[model samples]
Target: MKNRSNQQKKSDRSTSQGTSNIALMALSAVPLLMVLGNSMLIPEFPKIKSALDINQFQVGLLITLFSTAAGLSIPILGFLSDKYGRKIIIVPSVLVYGLGGIISGLGATLLDDSYLIILIGRVVQGIGAAGTAPIVMAMVGDLYKSNDRSEAMGVIEAANGIGKVISPVLGSAVALISWRALFFSYAILAIPISLGVFFLTQEPTHQGQKEKLSSYLKKILQIFREKGPSLLISLFAGMAVLFILFGVLSHVSDILEKEYNLKGLTKGLIIAIPILFMSSFSYLTGRYLKQKGKFFKIAIITGLTIVGSALFFLPFLKKPYIYVGILTIMGLGSGFVLTSVNTLVTSSTTSEQRAG
Candidate 1:
């Protein structure tokens, strides 16, 4: 009788631990999908630009559309999720994201210019994405204690790296067949992920009762004012710079051919080299963060590395190898900075605020 009772207790304990691990893993998926959706589009941009006959400026706008929408929507949805619940916001967002993917694919097929339609689809994607990534990070903060939270965030970032690593190759393969297919593929990816999230994940409750919108906004403003306004400003500025870099890199093949006389596969490989390094280093950084919780040091190092790389590029502006080296350093620096910043942000806020 005693042996049987002990065995059952052990089994229950194991089951509880297993459940907790799965929950953490699921939280990681939110960021993973967010990054995957964006990264996949990178390799396909050439095909998209050529098919739509869009200018560089127009191509840049497509990225801007997605990011701007995401930025506007994240805080709003985060606040709503804090008031209502994460699952309520998340499930609908996933569905909208899938719809956006379908619309993007259809727009690519049906529209004469297609750029406008694609832009609309990207905007929808951004809106839907707002609820998932940030909310998931907030949820992790709610679920885990401080020490564990950093590791959880690192795991989430690692998952994102996995998605980013796969996206380029997968997108290239899909684009080779049909550019429209890439968007449809994203829709397919979203459906199963959404279903899983809807059925499996539980919405975390705030520790305290919800605050008024005005109050919440006031608190957010206070946090920015008190904790790290200058740091936050610098981070946002860095993000904008990175976005511009990504936009330019997306058109590297054209630049290489137009300016340097590089041709075909070589141009493709050159562009890809930096991305490969970035993905690899991002994964490594995530792993490092999981083991060590030196957020400020990582952030500072990342910033310095980026500044140094940018300076290095100025000296060898025309050399392809120098560009590649700079990009690799930039990627490593970005990975370190992003992971550190995310950890800091999540830690700074309460669970409710994080959700907000």
Candidate 2:
């Protein structure tokens, strides 16, 4: 009888773990898709500018507008998710994102003057993006406990890194067919991911639904007051790392094509090098942090130092191998910093206020 009980318990544990893996995978897709909304378009930017007869500044607005929209909407979406549920908000948001992509593709393909239409579509996609990766981070916090949450956070960051590595190459390849095709690809890819997230993941119970909005706001404010310094610093580190990574990538893409005569898939493959390093380091750092939570401050400091050193040396290194080597080091630093920040931010709060 004891043996039978033990066997059943073991079986249940295995089943539960398997289910958790599936759910994590589904959640990871949200960040990957959200990333694709922007990074995948980087390689296509010059082509887009020329096709639409727009200036560099005008073309740049595509990314700026999307980012601005997503940034503005995130807090509101987080509040809604806290009130209702993560999955409910996520499902419709993904659908909206895909719809936005479709509109952009149609306008670009069928219209003579389509820049305005495309910009509108990008705004819509950005709003959808606001509900994606951030909510997934909060949901993961709600679902897991202790080291498991940290590990899951790492996995999510790694997924975002992987998306970055993939986007450039994928964008260039698709652009070989038609740049408009890239827009439609967003919709094509989002559908399955959205469905997977809806069905595969389960949200843990949240107390925010019963709490008054005013009380919830007060609680969040209190959390900020208590952890304000550390949280702000962590947030800043995350923002700086991402800004550097993306800014470097955009510049590299342009120069690789203009100066090095490396365009299309060749340019993209080169762009992927730094991102690949970043992704690998992110996965490793996440695992390490899970095991050694006490080293959070050290990891953050070390990452920042490495990134700073790399940037300082960048101006003098014009040789291809040397330049790429520096970028690779920077990528490693970014991966470490971002994984630590993400884990810290998500695990700091309780389920009730996590999404908010």
Candidate 3:
């Protein structure tokens, strides 16, 4: 990282125009859409169950299927994106995502027990998701000069935060019209964003080969071996941060609706409060990396500690403000963890190695 930092400093001296902020705004939509789509679905789960005549177990699979498919496909897509270019992979992925959404939307509109078709749509969307956010991470690193890199990365992270903050509200608003419209919204988003990436983003300069599938898998293992044990720790830490945030949110929306007797826009607004803090702090962390990067290890440790402590106290809270305050507090730590881990990975590799 020090070496990369020094290199970035040298590169920063050159006034490379690189990717414009406009282009970045376009890329920012990817993550914002991802989180927004998922969080919005959380509120829609029960509604979807009723509309589709599915049981609780099947309703659960709406989220589960999407995640499982995305998780499984990312590694493979990572390799393909490396072999090809980010543009080539991303355009198709976005289109596939739109197709999935359309399928789900049509299924919901046309049939009552269209659960099977909707499930298929989610699976397709998940497969497309495999290429969306992960590839964007690699592209952000490729598109910026080192000095601008942190800020660029920050903006994307900020967009992610913004998504979290607004998703519930947006989702609630959209669902008011028809829950089926929610699926169409995914299609609506994917099309323009895909076109933006295709036309606006430049093909990055890199030295990676289009490896044979056999060799690609072998190289992935080799990367693990070369980086040694600390990589595992980093991976685990990043995993835990996302795991905690998503796991809590998965139940939080329902709990608020059922236990606290909150619903609709009010529920969404409440859910967004703490997440607003998380996004704000994530942007701040990225912008001030020159100072904070010096305390990377400290930031990671301190952030996790704050998260754990806040979450520990959440179970005892009785008021809405208390929940909001605790999550806001947790967001500070989450921002640190997310920004640090995201920067570590994005900055550490070239466009090619990032694919693995």
Candidate 4:
């Protein structure tokens, strides 16, 4: 009888472990999908600009509007996720994201002057994006503890880096079918991912009374009070690296096309080199930082210094390969910076206060 009981307990533990691994994969998809929403459209910018008969600055608004809407909506969506549950916010938001994509694709294909319609659809997509990757960060915190939390956050960042690595190539390839096809792909992709998040991942059950808004606010404030400077620095570092990364990618795409006369897959392959370095480094960084809480500050500083040095030399280089080499160095720095920042922020507070 005792042997049977022990066997049963072992079986349960194995089952639980398997479920957790599946859940982690679904969660990782959240960031990757969110990245595809924007990054996948980047390589098509010139084609889009020409199609819509818009200037560079005007065409740029598509990305700008999406980001702006997402930024503005994130806090509201975060609060809702805190109240309702991460999956609830994520599932519907993903559907909305898909819907927005369909709308944009239709407008681009069917309308004569569809620029405004496309912009509107991007705004909708942005709102959906707001509830995705950011909530996944908090969701991971809710689901894991201690060293697992660090490792999971690292995987999340790595997924994000991987998305960056693939998006340019994916975008270029899809645009071959038709640039409008790119917008429609979002809907197709979101359905399975949302279903996975809804079904495969389980949200941790919160026991006891839900905190009132006042109490929640106070707890959040206290966390900031204790870790305000470090938190702020981490936030800034994360944002700065992404800004540098996307800005470099946009510029590089244009340079490849106009200067080198490279287009489509060749251009995309070149663009992906740096991002591949970033993703590879991000995974390695995450593994190294596991349970080593003391090294967060040092990692951030080292990563930023590497990025700064690379950026300094970038303008002086006239050769495409060398320029790409410098960006690869930058990507390496970004991988370290982002993984460290993600782990630090997620681990800084309890799940209850994470969204706040």
Per-model TM against the reference? 0.82, 0.81, 0.80, 0.83
Candidate 4 segments exceeding 4 Å error: 1-3, 144-155, 207-237, 283-309, 312-316, 339-352
Q: What clash pairs does model 3 have?
A: none
User: Model 3, residue 52: what's the lDDT?
Assistant: 80
Off by over 4 Å in 2: 1-25, 53-60, 137-158, 199-208, 226-229, 295-298, 343-352
Superposing all C-alpha atoms, what RMSD in Å does each candidate have to the true structure? 3.7, 3.6, 7.1, 3.4
lDDT of 1 at 90: 76
User: Of 1 and 2, which scores higher on lDDT?
Assistant: 2
Residues 36-117 of candidate 2: C-alpha lDDT, one tens digit per residue: 8888888777678779999877877888888889988897788888888888888889988998899899999999999999
10 residues in a row with least lDDT, candidate 3: 13-22
Q: After superposition, how far is residue 302 of candidate 2 from its true place, in Å?
A: 4.0
RMSD of 1: 3.7
Local distance difference test, each candidate: 0.71, 0.86, 0.78, 0.86
Selected candidate, larger TM-score, 2 vs 4: 4
- Candidate 4 local accuracy as lDDT? 0.86
For model 1 the local lDDT of residue 351 reads: 58
lDDT of 2: 0.86
State the lDDT at 48 in candidate 3.
78
